[model samples]
Target: MRRSAVLGGRYVLRSLIGQGGTAEVYCACDRVLEREVAVKLLRQASVEERDRARFADEARLLGRLSHPGLVTVLDAATSDEEPYLVMELVHGPSLADCCRGVALATTRVAAIGAQLAEALRYAHDNGIVHRDVKPANVLLAEDDRALLTDFGIARLLSASTGHTATGTAVGTAAYIAPEQVRGEPVSPATDVYSLGLVLLEALTGERAYDGSPAEAALARLTTPPPMPSTLPAGWRDLLLAMTALDPADRPTTVEAVDSLRRLAAETEPAKPGFTGRTDVGESPATRSTAGSLPGSAVVTAAAGQLRTTGLGAVSRPAGLARRAGLAWRWATAAVLALVLVLGVTLWSNTLSGRPPQRDTPAGVPDRVQKPLQDLHDAVEGDR
Candidate 1:
């Protein structure tokens, strides 16, 4: 459709934003409301009963749901056998796009998971289940906030839209739960499992499951999802429980959010106002008191030992050069004493500024005495 076309008598289609299997979302101007909106239109061939119903189901479900972390659906209608939905136009790319080729910090991943969990908890409380919670389904704003979107595969608990199923698979393969893969009935745990995979990928550069759809789906059934060995202990524990094989063993949305919050708190950058800690590159000797140290103290401690930078008395680092400097000073004194003795004994007969004496040390060559004389002169001159 051209930009001149208008849908439902009020929305003017301007440009295409995204394309999916069942719908095309366009950036549109709301004629009646005088604002920008995202219009998701069903394809002409997809105007069949099943497709329209699914589109309508998403519209109705999202129209009633509201949260800071969820995209808002504004309106829904059918015009001449063509159905479309008007939604809030999110201004950023999906989490999948932002996460591509990057390894996110654990605290950041936890913050994103916390918001998504809160949104899911609200949906669950209202008798709705977001069956798909992959990275592509989340929109991230420029300010680092995440908003969960795409309710195309959501199941309404009230059975009004007829989405309930057993032994039916309906989610992305890489992040789908084991039960979903096995075509079993799904609950909130299913979404939790999917989010767990997303978090795993976010924390680590690699995904837990990789391969074609068939291979990825079948592998999780027999083999456990990969648990990252390098993550912090709290992160590992939470992810393990979230991706448990059994739905009952998995953490609830509330519990998962709590765990994420705790993980974030533990990994959060140390702040003077908050009672939290950051474990990045800290040693065991300083880990306990790292958060309590001042900024200058941190820099000083990292640069050297717990020594004073002239602010007070300090302990010197046990360096080989400093120890050698003390040893060299003592050795220089002994060498000076020996050189003085040799100089007086060897040059007694040719003494300057003194009475001549007929005495010279036996078996001492002039070659050796000359070097000692130069050394004694240099040492005395230096003093």
Candidate 2:
């Protein structure tokens, strides 16, 4: 559609914002509402009966859904020569663009994943399964809120939408679940698996499966998605569970939302100038004390001890480091105390006019025999 072209006599098409294999999305203006909206129109050349039906299905599905994390459908016309859908305009970039080959912070991934999972939960609750839940279909609003869009291949669990027959794969291969590759039936778990891949990609700055579409799709059948050990334990566990080969083993959308929200809350960044302890295992009193200490003091003490003692290179937890430092101090104190006691005894013998022993052990060097004999005599006298 040309720019300035009017659709449904109310929406005026602007410039093209996004293009997919089946449709082109344009930034359009709703003349009646006097607001900007997104217009997704099926490509004229590819508008067949199947594509038309799928477009209609998406409109109907989105029309019934109301969620902050989901793009709201404002208007749709499927009977026209070119079918189009008008939706609420999202102001920011797509999730794919936001994290394109760039790893996002763990907290950011958690926040986005939580929002997407919640949106998926709502859709699944309403009998909708978004078959294509890749990053491109997820929009990031100005506030960084994730809005799931483009339910073009979504299936209604209550009824069969003839566009996607049983045993037909219908999503992007890189983000699709194992079941999708095998052409098995799709469910909410299928969406969970895809979301897992999306989050993994966001965290790792790379696709879990990369190759030709056929190769990517087939790889999931035999190998599990990679969960790097560098990822937080919570993230690693959740991603592994979400991408489990068996759908039955994957968490529900509700569970995924809970886990993601928890992780997001837990991994939230510290406020500026915040001196509070980040370790959750610390007691309230311990945290309060640690927080009360000057930041420089804590850093200096830990770093100085670690550096001087050659323990800085050891990768140990804070608790272990503290224990090791304490042990080192104790051992040093014991050695110093023993040396002090021996020195005091030798000084007392010398002051008391007691002659130091002349005989030295056979192994003792002649140059140091006087001092060695004095030390040995002091120890024997003490015993």
Candidate 3:
């Protein structure tokens, strides 16, 4: 029989929300505060000496981070025979749930992706790498907020805990980086790669490399992705840079983040009802809505250029298997291109008889609106 709840002095577990390889997260109530919190309990069977240390490490990690888009750690402790972390309860859907039902608008996806990048930059700067980043870990909070969760498999620079064969594979296979597969020491670049896959899933409304976990992992080593033409043009090179087979070949996470920010800037004038900070070469109306993501995470300039190095400087480890992986990418790309061509041809035929419809609204002018209302004004005044 399973216990329905863990009744503690300060907190009471309501039900389990998620169970991973090492930890099980529960929805709990803080008896003192009378508020809900997520209590992540480390599975006793999974708690090795290193895992216990890692559990303790999360408190220190969360202490260093303060961001609106990140899930905050409220408290941590070990009780009876369980180690638990109390966290902010994010009440909303997962990115995976969103993707399964709806293809996110490009701007919305960019907004979410940008926020995630900002969080990653902050973590990387603080010498932490969120080794496992995936859709399930991202929460769409109420009031249209995008929050990142689940730092259980995160790696801290000062810790000896790592997924180097002796440990279980850390990340979801679909989002794992190439270097991680080879058992090489990981850096911020690995996070960039995983985030790239997140962005890829965001855009395509499908997995970038899909199949069994084993097949997907094999594909990552050998798959040269088809050209960016299939993706919204804005995301092409950024994805290529992040998903490059060689860890050295991939752009630094900070650079990739900057590229995303710039792309968002270019998109500002085109999005309707935007009013944020404006920069040079942009209209003041657009300025108020540009780069002014309130409560959005920030990447300090120095950290943005941390370990400045160009892609292609770091070489993929030399091995027959890696070379074969490279060759496999070319082959996979060819197949992908062929499939793309066929799909386009079929899609063209479906719409061949109908006239093209304009994307802009019919009655409204085709121009960006100087949003008379801001988020704060709308939420506060109206309510």
Top lDDT model: 2
Model 1 error, position 47 (Å): 2.6
Distance from true location, Cα of 12 in model 3, Å: 2.0
Q: Model 2 — which ten-residue stretch has the worst lDDT?
A: 287-296
Preferred candidate (TM-score higher): 2 or 3: 2
Q: Per-residue CA lDDT of candidate 2, range 198-225, in tens? A: 8977776566654333344434553446
* All candidates: CA RMSD (Å): 30.4, 27.7, 18.8
Candidate 2 stretches with Cα past 4 Å from truth are: 1-4, 268-383
Tens-place lDDT per residue, model 3, 1-383, is 24336545688888767665467777889989999988877666556655676677666677578888788888877533567778888777677666642345666777788788888888888888887777767788777777777665578766565533321234555577766644456778888888887776665445555433334544555553332233444566677677777777777766776777777665432222212121111111110001100111011112111111211111222221221224444544443333322322222232244332223223432221111112112112111
Q: How do all models score by TM-score? A: 0.67, 0.68, 0.64
Candidate 3's error at 175, in angstroms? Answer: 1.0
- The Cα error of candidate 2 at residue 199, in Å, is 0.2
For model 1, how does the per-residue alpha-carbon lDDT over 38-111 read when each residue is reduced to its tens digit?
88877675456666777778888888998988888888885445678888888877766555545577788889
Please identify which of the two predictions, 1 or 2, would achieve the higher TM-score against the true structure. 2
Whichever of 1 and 2 has more lDDT, that candidate is 2
